[model samples]
Target: MWPFTKRPKDPVLDPSYGDPHRKALIRALEKRKWKFARELLNMAADPDEMAFLMEAVGGVDGIQDWIGDWMDAEPESTLPVLVAGCHAVRWAWEARGGKRAKYTTAAQFKGFHERLRHAEALLQRVLAREPDNVTARAWLVTSSRGLGVGPAEARQRFEAVTRLHPGHLVAHEQRLQYLCAKWSGSHEEMFDFARGAATAAGPNSLLHELVAVAHIEKWDATEREEGNEYIVSDEVRAELLTAAEDSIFHPDYVPAGPGWAPRVATFAMAFELADEFDAAGHAFALLDGLVTEWPWQILGDPVEKFTASRDWVTTNRS
Candidate 1:
């Protein structure tokens, strides 16, 4: 009797309906049921629903391609999907371990840098439309840093992110990195930043390494006992020595390229404080591996030789 005045479509048939299928797909994804979700999405009737389902199961590259197709079909659409795609790519990169991938050649680094730039540009465009988007702003800053943007530009972006969202942890960490690079030889500033970060972020291994590096740099430069004492607390020195020994045997922390230097330096500090022979031995072993793995042609023979020799001398002498 109310047919004419009734809603145009049955709620059950409405795409917004509980979408039992979508719910099931989301559940499967949450449970890490990749295979089931992938199968269901392939059979879903709605394109948008299928897109979301695919994204749930397929990971970053999949989402990027799916969203790219959607954009090609509907250029005037809002950017939620594209934004999600950018997030997926960023997550994928992070899951590979931030800035520590073992690249075979200079070309790979260039390619990675370009991909990071592309993601940053897309997020920037999104932020332009939505000025209050803190997540997009954060991603932009992180991507900019990943692309090796100079400290000044990265700091500006990080400062803007902090202004928009004061408690952003990643922005704070990135700022610390920028400070470290900017004041490379300044142990006081670097230690201050590292201590603040450790207090704020709570005993992160990376922050400990940063603090250790600052101390090691000072000690290496001045050959002073005060610098050595300042870098490694007695407790941390023991833990670091243990970690260095494990890393030497297992090499769980053999991050490639410039990444190795920080870990190596941290281990050296630990060895200095603990006077552990094996820890010192392992540090040089890993450094030697880095030299062998790194491309001397692109990275330069002089730099490689210097690093290799430096590691050898430090390990043997102390």
Candidate 2:
């Protein structure tokens, strides 16, 4: 499951699975702190934190059901609309098929399409009612990509959202996925988007993250033997280092509360793939011990792989 079940509570829940950021989101919803929750989420300046908020709410099946209650409680609030759309698109992402998987049942693909369409409808409603809700628009772009609406169309959706709320991390990353060659977007286009987005967003912003993600995804798209050497290239290496300086290593880099961990986690993984364990160690240190499923799960057994990667880095550091 792309959006796996919530960290299981039974049979001795792994402490490593207890993400503070995810906990905070659930707590906000449970306590009905709509304004506080939304305000807290708005501080997320990067894709890492944004993804955490989106996934924490959207990954679970029950969130869509909860959206009705939230809407009922705060009928005029844009938060509910954003949450509703985010949950739908995120769930649809899990259901959507990809070449990486050996098999995806037709039923699964159908469910994916249905959920994606539902997400699209919900976002459209949000836009119609609250025309300037950029988060809803971002989710709309993501849902559109999942629905296979084509990269050009997705770019239009993304650009429309950014025009309203510039430097939207989710919108940038979603468009990156839309532009991937595997999805019919070329490598050249993806890097250009990443670099341009980072440059536009400026330093100390997590927008540089697009560079890291672009490199990793492009590597995956290429042949394994050749791709293994992709990170070693002078160009890719230079971009990743610059991205690091502009974001994570910048003096003004702020964690934005518990949301900071994902930024570190993502950066660490990028460094790991680049064979720069020293840099990876810096990212891993910020994470403490909390590892998210993604970036690592992109390889295998998120927990195991993360722990092993950490151990290797630590050992080499000594």
Candidate 3:
């Protein structure tokens, strides 16, 4: 997997991979209950959920057709714009290449690029009309990533959103991707962004999740051997614990539904990969059989990968 493998897979990156709520979420969308759908999106406590909900609503070609009618009915309705725009970013991301563009044909890359532009066009239109919609700005961060924008522009868009809505976890998550080494960013930049973000959000905020995000990016930047070392290294592990103490493991810790599971999975996978089973067990306990198709699926079959790591930690615990 490291130097780049020939065969590539992952039939679906659906965020509903392990949660029950999303099954009902699909039902609401099928019935055209746009009000309920809007409620769900508004209630999403983090970016992963926002990304998932948008993909579920309009990741396909035909489903977003209703958005036009909705927009015509309510010119001020930013919901349709958000759905359509975020969907473009998701479609582009789903088509993106990985670790040296393995298995990504030229046609596929071009298509993904087109989707990024489509998303930008929609987001720009909304910004021109509404001008101050932080949701649009957040999706702009994602669209910028697919366009292969440099770190500075990405950071500017991120600041524009966070300046309006601090602790916007979804924007923060996108910022992590924007600052990753694979995307013209270095490890130092990624780690600095993560640390500063988590700190700014203060105690008891989900922003601390960026620590695990930084570790994941650090692992992504180094060779497999060195990367593994860096993840489990004393420095990274210490910060991970500090992050947990400041939020996840704090006496006041609270769950924000299945939408919050990816934050835990990030640590669970990291600790498991680092051979730190106990820490992984703590993460698993919080997971409570729930998961999200992220940071984990980025490796392979997400469920299989999660189970293998979870099983390894369980054996060590017993």
The alpha-carbon lDDT assigned to residue 276 of candidate 1 equals 53
lDDT of 3 by residue, 1-41 (tens): 01112222332344564555565556666776666766777
Q: lDDT values of the candidates?
A: 0.48, 0.72, 0.73
Determine which window of 10 residues in candidate 3 has minimal summed lDDT: 1-10
Clashes of 1: 0
> Superposing every Cα of model 3 onto the true structure, what RMSD results?
6.5
What lDDT is obtained when candidate 3 is compared to the true structure? Answer: 0.73
lDDT of 2 by residue, 86-154 (tens): 888777767764435347777888989999888888778788888876667777877776677866787
Cα TM-score of candidate 2: 0.82
Best-to-worst lDDT order: 3, 2, 1
RMSD to truth, every model? 18.3, 6.5, 6.5
Clashes (backbone N, CA, C under 3 Å), per candidate, total 0, 0, 1
